[model samples]
Target: MGWLKMPLREGVAALQNSIVSELQRNWPALVTLTPDLLGLEYPGETTLDFLEAIRDLTDSGMVTCEAIIISSNDGPRMVDAALTARGRAMFEPKGRAAA
Candidate 1:
């Protein structure tokens, strides 16, 4: 896929979007997704990239995620993820009140 060849900036953006969309698809449920799971979706990204994207989304308040340290080599990685209020707002149709 073209995403596999996308530049770092575009790829990271796509990763972040994918993260949010996955949570959105599941809605109110907290989903546990390891790096391996994410890798299946974006074969182009490294584990580090997925960790960074999770941090970015969490820092931005778009999503609430928990980072689990698998080992020294793995460092801190996000596992459980769910959209925050801000994140849910992104999917809301224009002119509709947020639930």
Candidate 2:
């Protein structure tokens, strides 16, 4: 998929902002890909992209995501903040078949 490219450092920040919190733990429960259940347009894709980008930050002690969850007051929304070795973050959408 076409993604907005940036830098590794930015990817790290993006992942942290998207998943990591001030829990002060070595590992996280899971990436917990946030989703809008109401079904928006690109929120889910944007969130999943970050989840896929996890490959980029794995070496940096970043946490990995498990199952993706979708939820939205108005529409289902899920966004990924996974990091990519290409030194950037991306939005990896779930398979269209599942949609």
Model 2 earns a TM-score of 0.29
TM-score of each: 0.67, 0.29
Question: Which residue window of length 10 is worst by lDDT in model 1?
Answer: 1-10
Clashes of 1: 0
Off by over 4 Å in 1: 1-10, 40-45, 72-77, 93-97
Clash pairs, candidate 1, are: none
TM-score of 1: 0.67
Query: In angstroms, what RMSD does candidate 1 have relative to the true structure?
Result: 7.3
Model 1 residue 20 distance off true place after TM-score fit, in angstroms? 0.6
lDDT of each: 0.68, 0.36
Candidate closest to the true structure, highest lDDT? 1
Write model 2 residue lDDT over 1-99, tens digit each, in one string: 866655544344555444433211212221233322212244545454443444444435343333334445522222333333222222223442210
Candidate 2 runs further than 4 Å off: 1-6, 9-12, 22-31, 35-49, 65-99
Q: What digit string (tens of lDDT, one per residue) describes model 1 on residues 3-88?
A: 24324454677778778778877878888766665554333346667766776777778888665554555444466778889978
Best-fitting candidate, measured by TM-score?
A: 1
